[model samples]
Target: MKVTSHRDEIRVSRLLGASRYRVEKPFLSEGVIYGFFGATLGLLISFLLSLYFQGPLNRFFDPVKFIESDPFFYLSVAALEIIGGILVGYFSSWLSVRRFIKF
Candidate 1:
């Protein structure tokens, strides 16, 4: 039942008039922003790599040019990944901070 430094900081913030929402919001928002940035970067790198390797891939597989021919499929997948990233980030941050803020 000993209060750790992390809990102390949360308690101090509450005592100093910061609302629970105010304290938790930043963590959630930061998680979301980071998730979005990470997902976008990952998607960009993957797309570029696929483009760069298209010739080798086509030569090896003979019918693997979906990247340029069916771009909407890739776009949909990218959208889903970004959305999933944002959701995971928000939930993880919320879960992590929920125990620290007593109120």
Candidate 2:
């Protein structure tokens, strides 16, 4: 939970024993560089899944009639996915950070 005044620094760690950790404080990009690299892996997984399943998903759902009948159903599903992703992402991020700080 220590935020250095100079942002380009961080504490790396190793677990020495149960409930004990050894920290090696170092100067770096304060994880900005590592953050981007790590973040992209998550995005790539999401993108690849969406891309590869585009066809199979349609076959499974068979929403063509609904789309033809009214576009609102499709739009509603899209909106729900967007809203759900935002909520899940926000809460998951918060939960992880809180756990890390507590640890």
Winning candidate number (lDDT): 1
| True-structure lDDT of candidate 2 | 0.47
Q: What is the C-alpha local distance difference test score of each model?
A: 0.79, 0.47
| Per-residue lDDT over 1-103 for candidate 1, one digit per residue giving the tens place of the 0 to 100 score | 1123457776778899998897788778978997898889989999899999988878998865454558788789999999988998888777777755557
lDDT: worst 10-residue window of model 2: 19-28
| Best-fitting candidate, scored by TM-score | 1
Candidate 2 lDDT over 1-103, as tens digits, reads: 3233322322233233322122222212323334444555555676689999988888988866443457787567655655555555445544444454344
